[model samples]
Target: MPKPLYQCRVLVTATSYGVHDPALKTTLESQVGEVVYNQSGRPFTAEELAALIPGFDACIAGLDRFDRQVIARADHLRVIARYGTGVDNIDLDAAREKGIIITNTPAANADSVAELTVGLILALARNIVVADRETRAGLWPRLQGISVNGKTVGLIGFGAIGRRVAQKLSGLGCQILAFDPYTDPASGEGLAHFTSREEVIASADFLSLHCPLTGQTRGMVDAAFLKSMKRGAFLINTARGELIDEAALIAALNEGHLRGAALDVFTRQPPGADHPLLAMPQVIVTPHMGAHSDHAANAMGWGALNNCLAVLRGEEPENRVV
Candidate 1:
């Protein structure tokens, strides 16, 4: 339709979307003229990306790094459409200097991520994993677990995902507290109430991170922060792995300063088999599937491909981050 809008040579680095739906690939091929694809089914490193991206006009990027070294070598890369909400993997300054348009599927998977966050909170509070494990092992074990109802739940950030979480938790009778200086207070109305960071850390029964991974936010949940949290509090993180200090979280759980933690993201993905956290009975972990529902995948794939097409057509992308 409409002459396919644009024409260029593109790389489809994120394999899930177009591969699952060939028509989507055909649509992208129609606009880009020729599209190369990544069949490896995983994210590529800087070196790998540098080698694969030089001749491409645009990329349907996943979590691959497009740093200065990679972007500097990209002789023809005009745009990058990030497959997910986060742009932390891409070096914004480098992309800007290289005149490469960077776009993300903002809020494309917000509902999915928010739902996962809530699920993690419940899993943490209810000892869901442990119970399931014990039952599967033929042991009738019962453990006392905290309930979310009437609990003081704290949100570290009030972005789209955080707001969605607050709205969902409201249905469960939780008193939500949000701490985000940059966020508009109106975002938390009815669902949550704006509060001071210290207050959230000191008072919440359950604490969840919904912030991005930035220089200021990386490793924000350190020893002092964990120590300040309410005793026997539970931590839920569906955000970036770098946001929390993993060792500190383990210490908090071991010392009984915190009850438990449910993590959908980790400091090291697919952490080593012998990782201490994996052996800990108080911890529950998932393979970072917060934004991975079929519905979300379709939306993200469509958004990422269209974003590249938009930039190729000399129009503003739907979610340009840089």
Candidate 2:
């Protein structure tokens, strides 16, 4: 006998789920018997998820730590609908073994993230943060800044977000060089010049990362990689945090090997008040807010909601990842 759709129980962990639009929540509640929201205000740890997952049929997930043990404890969980595109936080192998379907909303937040990446680039080039701080402190200091026009901008990955970024910067007259082994050259068209990783790294005036985090890319930006970069060039990461070695970055910035860095994600969430990166005025950091735009929020919410409902109703989801 099939479980009744109205008797299905769903768990939602994303903090901003349905925040921009109430219709997402209303639609989800109408389809499922019960919807439990995460009250923790942050991603739940594996232990916390292990305690709460046993009875749920589906989950609209955030960046929660969905490790092997957590998946093993999800006795009835059939699907996990990620609110954002990245699935690095979820343990795919364990989910596959457990026959738990995973779906993510691709391109849902691409524009939002790309916009922030450009903003960070501009902010870093112009030292906007320092200027704002000094001005608000009742000191008017004339600052020298570089122009983005004709600058050689490098992109580490040329996926959806990267492509969007390239398109946005085209009018700025930047020489966009991108490296992504998996992307087809035709896909980029006139947006970016696809090139070797080494060339992109060495030639860029401002290097931005848009790659997904994986075993191959973890800590790829180490001391050696950072040392090879063009002296005094800036680094920007709107991708995953673990991609760069934080200690190496700190050392590079300390010794003036790199001019500055702008980070939207970190190796650790809320990298604390006393974190070394926060103390550097040259570095700009945000609380992983690259995809928090209202438009992005609504799209992610609706996509995740639809995914959860589709799987629960025994239908195929549009964005099945595993």
Candidate 3:
């Protein structure tokens, strides 16, 4: 492929692509005019990003905060290609106001995330993590586990990952209930029924959150939400961590109102080693590996790169968000 007429400088803030697969990095480097890898292992602070991004023409955004202050400093930035689906971390309004094109690789990691959601549900239902720990310690005690078969599972979001979760659970004879006002009820292929959010919370034996973190959804699952759930019901969140109040979750579990919880995302990226949730025997936690599968990482990296390059080349990108 020949270089575009105008070669634009690119800053890749997502650090995992090179580690996941060097070919992904290579593909990105070959297309863009210039590329800068994030030297820091983690996401850049607003101050750090603002200073680093001024010279770059496009950026591959990760979980970095691109607030108004940061966006204001990006004098030469033309596009922001988000490495993942959720763009809540980016200041979309600021980007829009600056006339910077924003794009995300939606559904690029759907299969991986959806699979992880089902895995969490199964782990919580069957006490897989608990059982493994005990057996490893030489205490071979059998524990009672709930079966998902014939049980109803509620999905709070009916997007790509939610639909895949329902489809996967249907094979296990699990009934699905979905609560997303945006999706049509008939689109669930008879595997799930679209219903009121309140109904799903009260009726389902298991409730899984797959909704995006928006102004409407932030801290949505608080005391009231937990109180409305069926007693001893299980909760699974593979979506945004800010959706559920961590304090409310702890209280619900302690009061015996809920059985167990499985979390893939946390309000904090890395909860402390001695975090209360980590010490809980009933709770299962994974370090946000919902979209860490090799296939998903590769697709997301490639998509983010191409979307950014498209804008640099003055072409319309498929995944434009702003």
Query: Which candidate should be chosen as best, given TM-score against the real structure?
Result: 2
Q: Output the worst ten-in-a-row residue range by lDDT, candidate 3.
A: 1-10
TM-scores for all candidates: the values are 0.95, 0.98, 0.95
Worst 10 residues of 2 by lDDT: 1-10
What is the per-residue lDDT of model 2 for residues 1-322, given as tens digits with 9 covering 90 to 100? 4478799999999999988898988888988899999998999998999999999999999899899999999999999999999999899999999999999999999999999999999999999999999999999999999999989999999998999999999999889999999999788889899899999999999999999999999999999999999999999999999999999999999999999999999998878899999999999999999999999999999999889888887899999999
Model 3 bad stretches (over 4 Å): 1-6, 18-21
RMSD (Cα, Å) for all candidates, in order, is 2.3, 0.9, 2.2
Q: Candidate 1 on 1-322: residue-level lDDT in tens? A: 2123455788888757765567778888776678888878778888999888877788999877888899999998888999998999899999999888999998888899999988888888888889999999999987887778999999999998999999888889889999998999987778888989999989899999999999999999999999999999989899999999999988999999998888888887767788888888888888888987877788899999888888877788989898
Expressed as tens digits, the lDDT of each residue in 240-279 for candidate 3 is 9999999999999999999999999899888889788888
The positional error of residue 234 in candidate 1, measured at the CA in angstroms, is 0.8
Clashes of 3: 0
Each model's number of backbone clashes?
0, 0, 0
What TM-score does candidate 1 get on C-alpha atoms?
0.95
Which parts of model 2 have CA positions greater than 4 angstroms off?
A: none
